[model samples]
Target: MVYHVLNGDALVSGFKATGLSGEIIVARECLIEGDLKGETLPEFLENRARFVEDEFNEARVHYYNNVVPEFEKLLNAEPGSEFNLWFGYDLFCRANMWFVLSLLSHLEGDKEVNVVYPSFRDKHDIWLEFGRATSEQLQEAFDNRINFAGRDFRLAEDLWTAYKQTDLGRLHDLSIFHSPCFPYLPEVCQAHIDRFPYKGKKGRPERVIEDILKKNGRDFKTVFREFSAREGIYGFGDDQVRKIYDKVMKERNP
Candidate 1:
């Protein structure tokens, strides 16, 4: 049986409209933005559930109900199954995709894994393409999925470890060995590193938000559009940028 593991729910409708034959699994947790304080699978999931509850005010029960099962499937699927990974070329998608790979790495089997990219017309609009893909384009991508080799899974496993640990030095070292498995590993690494508070408790996103507000005058639409256009690397939607913008403004005014 074939399984489609999507990065988030936004792409689910588009995927289904393509008439693809597979069980669709949505990654509901924002793994990149939370503290992963567990090593074992069960432990890791519980930790994430707690993080989601405290960070987003979403109940832990919701996490267990919505997020845990899909991940468990990814972790405990039978050997020799086929999986098509549907993720974008952004840090948000990379984090989810890498975590999925890390789980698959623990399973020993002839698991056939493939990555399906968006049919993007412009290089700069990659992050936007997946969310806006047509059924025909989605089908085209699925028809031309890139199969992952054994080494690719190994690399993904290593990167996931370093990513959760936030080991900048190790990530820089690993970034040198580029692979098709990770389309933009080095670039994503740089973007990830840049998110940390580089100056006065303001990360790149926070700082950029500050700059946007100053130039565009407190217009939410203007800021969101500028941020999305300027920083496709993060692949943040309105909700994320809104959160960051609020934090920046709060701290600035306070």
Candidate 2:
């Protein structure tokens, strides 16, 4: 899929081929600029190369884990339908590549606002799912999906808020609920809190149970008792509860 960009209402070359070509050009430019220097140029190029290498690693992961899986699922279901499937698939690949480029552009510290052109023709999928969502339910879904895939929390949070006005409460609730499997989920909530972007600073939970109770509006003691009473549930003794309590308190205090 060819991804185009609109600059001042004029359509430009898409990122899949053009944008990558641009990156290579920039790298060459950097090398030329570095050549003018005596000692610092090598260090500068080394740092730039490291940054590019890191971005490439991240892009590969995002492609394999997020982009490819979605395309594979669609391909498996459809088999040999060639009308829009291939086009859409190619576009999605470009979009994912564009997303990586977007991050790289930021790291490169370019003054011009470089818009990352997605390979996909339609921007709906790019924004609706790949970008951040505004609705509470969709935001939660996106958060959970990111956590399950073990993506960068900051990136997930940025994507969550880019396209919509999200309620911080909804994000907090979702993060806490999904924290066990998604250990880094707490970082997104923390980032939100650090910005003071919303009202009502309900105290964060110290432990998993406390977090669940606070987020879900449940009584932790009652829930624990019920679970303990259930057969084969309380494999650990009361010491486990004490340990959990201690850990929760420590986190809260710390």
For model 1, residues 122-161, the per-residue Cα lDDT tens digits are 6767777486788888888788788898888888888888
Please list the residue runs of candidate 2 whose C-alpha ends up more than 4 Å from where it truly belongs after superposition. 1-163, 179-181, 197-254
Return the TM-score for candidate 2, rounded to 2 decimals: 0.19
* Per-candidate TM-score against the hidden true structure: 0.94, 0.19
Error of 1 at 207 (Å): 1.9
Q: Indicate the residue-level lDDT of 123 in model 2.
A: 37
Model 1 residue 167 CA deviation (Å) reads: 0.5
User: Per-residue lDDT for 1-254 in model 2, tens only?
Assistant: 11122211111122232222221111111110111122342343345445434634544344345333432332233222211111011212222322333233233221222222223224323222122222343223322321112233343334334312335666566555442322334553454343342256433222344655455544446535532333111222244444455565566669
lDDT values for all models:
0.83, 0.31
Q: Lowest-lDDT window of 10 residues in candidate 2?
A: 25-34
